[model samples]
Target: MVLYKTPNLKTILLNVFQDGILPYDIEDVLSLLVQKHYLMNKEQFLNYYKNDINQFWRDVASLGFKRDEKKATAESNDINDLKEYPEDNDNDFNIDDFFDSDEFKKRSDAEDIDNDAFKRNVSLIKDYQGINNSNERKNEKLNDICKINQRLVEKIAGKYEKMVRGTCLNIDDLIAFGNHGLLKAIDKFVPDMGYQFSTYATWWIRQSITRGIADESRVIRLPVHLHEKIMKIKNEERQYENEFGAIDASELCKNINMSDDEYWRFKSIAYQFDQITHLETIVGTEGDTELQDLLPITITVGSKSVPPDYMLTPEELFEKKELHDELENTLECLTSREAEVIKLRFAINKPDTMTLEEVGEIFHVTRERIRQIEAKALRKLRHPSKSKKLKDFIKG
Candidate 1:
């Protein structure tokens, strides 16, 4: 429901020129004019302006404005000038030699003046009251321009403040953030870029306001980049649902070009911000059991019960005993080393089975040697004589 209005081109130009001089490069100003007013880029503007550049300059000229013919020619010949200063290939060439050359010496000598002494002499000139008065007038004009700009910034910020109502941040804070963005936009804006300043500044303003909300409104703060990504994912989800019938996780991942790990990680963080059940909320069918009552009570380490769920039931216990007796009789058929290895590997008494490496360390043999013996013992157990002893148990 928010309505955003873009400032007119004349308003932008008036604000820029109120200081009575162009603050940006001449090329930049021309480029902006070509884009915003003439609907052309720099190249096209140059072609069209070539014939009337002098007249154009005269129309825009103000105090201290003067054309630099030499500078303009140098700019036009920039590529050719680069060719004149080609890199020296010789590693032994002394760079200092160029600085000591006649051309460099002539340039330095022509510009050699004691800057401090010149300033001191100028300060001693009491007859130049007119110059001091002119400088004071310039300062006053600059102050007036600053006041006008300040008022404009406030007006723009006020509009944005209303848009962010009901957010955790107060109106004043929103305005302050918006004003900061406005100042930055003003500093970097190129009016001739075929766009209104309002359009550019609005983006900055909205970004600042939204960032403030993300930072202040969350119980657990997330990085700005993560928050922005979460918002983008939610928006994409809504768009996908509207276009397609249902959401497919793999398809969404492909569309966003995100890995499964990254998508799930962001989703988990976003879910933390959603509303959760309170401990006092009723959870059971009887309506008497609260959520907190259903939670397991924490027990101290010494008071913790040895989990009985893993213990064998009566029938299972009886079956296990019969199997153990059969295994013991069958193990007797193996060699002494093989019997020991089988018992240790299966953890007949110990809490956990021993690895081949552990059995090797105990018997003073390599793990490969232990493995070979175990394999040989298993082959022997599968013999007709030994197999017949356990055939009934296996069939049952």
Candidate 2:
């Protein structure tokens, strides 16, 4: 788990690297989002769903989920047999935008541009993007529709995740939003029309998420005034810092005409509302017993230790089942208090730790007693019996 206590816009953007996982408790806040009653259910009324979502319907319908697809068509046999569509009329659709940019090229190698094939795909998107009210018939070829839409879904997935105002989200949630938006566009697309389906679908995706949020949130906590203040003042200040180098929060306090405490409160609350969950600390596991000793004296732990399996490999992955078993087994061998010290040392510890002299002050132990416990734990790790269990604990 990637824990975080705070997140800036950059941190939020980085979260999208996961594609659609909108993490943090933002999903919790989504319930607070208000869905404006503009053209209520217009999207559903218009039959706008592209590939994946459409297939979701078909599969369900086929399994006698709903009666709609039962008499629908022979073409809708399965996901692959769904639909395909050719390129739309006369427009130069560019896949270059979908391709990683030059900045990405500078960091990595340039992607292969199958110019001919790309142009055809572009034409396809433009063709479908143009589709208007007249073209959407209830009975359409399932395959042509599904294939064109699936590719389009893949393409739009990037933008829907990227274009949102705030960057905070889990990788999986962002990807889900993008995929949902892309697929939504497919079902509602009118290729003969002039406007792009992407423009339309972005709204749909946002709407789905927003509607979901509104339905679930107990109270709408994001007041419009605060949102405006955050968007205007906070975003600009950060941008100014990026452009001019850096500014202290003190400078920001004077500029914003608020006390440091008040300013930070506003900033923190605003960022929280924006759902910018990032930082290793905030996302990381809590009550991590292994991490207890590495931390400082001021820290505290209440959460359970994070399982080893959650850590990514080649960095510090321990065999979770085995490591957990080791810890459980090792605990049996130690005194209740020894276990307490070990947990306190790593999990409950905080930044800028006290020296052994200071820790002795709190525990009423001579520095020697503390030293013995620390050394004993270290010595235990040298033995193969306790090494794996000792290793399973995380450090903040």
Best by TM-score: 1
TM-score for each model: 0.30, 0.27
The list of candidate 1 runs beyond 4 A from truth reads 1-176, 186-200, 274-396
**Per-residue C-alpha lDDT of model 1 across residues 295-368, encoded as one tens digit per residue:** 43121111111212123345556776787798788889888999989788877645558999999999999999
Model 2, 35-106: lDDT tens per residue?
322213433323433312333323322333221111212110211121121222111122222121121112
Candidate 2 regions with alpha-carbon error over 4 angstroms:
1-147, 150-156, 159-168, 187-234, 244-265, 271-396
Q: Where is the poorest 10-residue window by lDDT in model 1?
A: 74-83
**Which prediction has the highest lDDT against the true structure?**
1
Q: Report residue 150 deviation for candidate 1 (angstroms).
A: 11
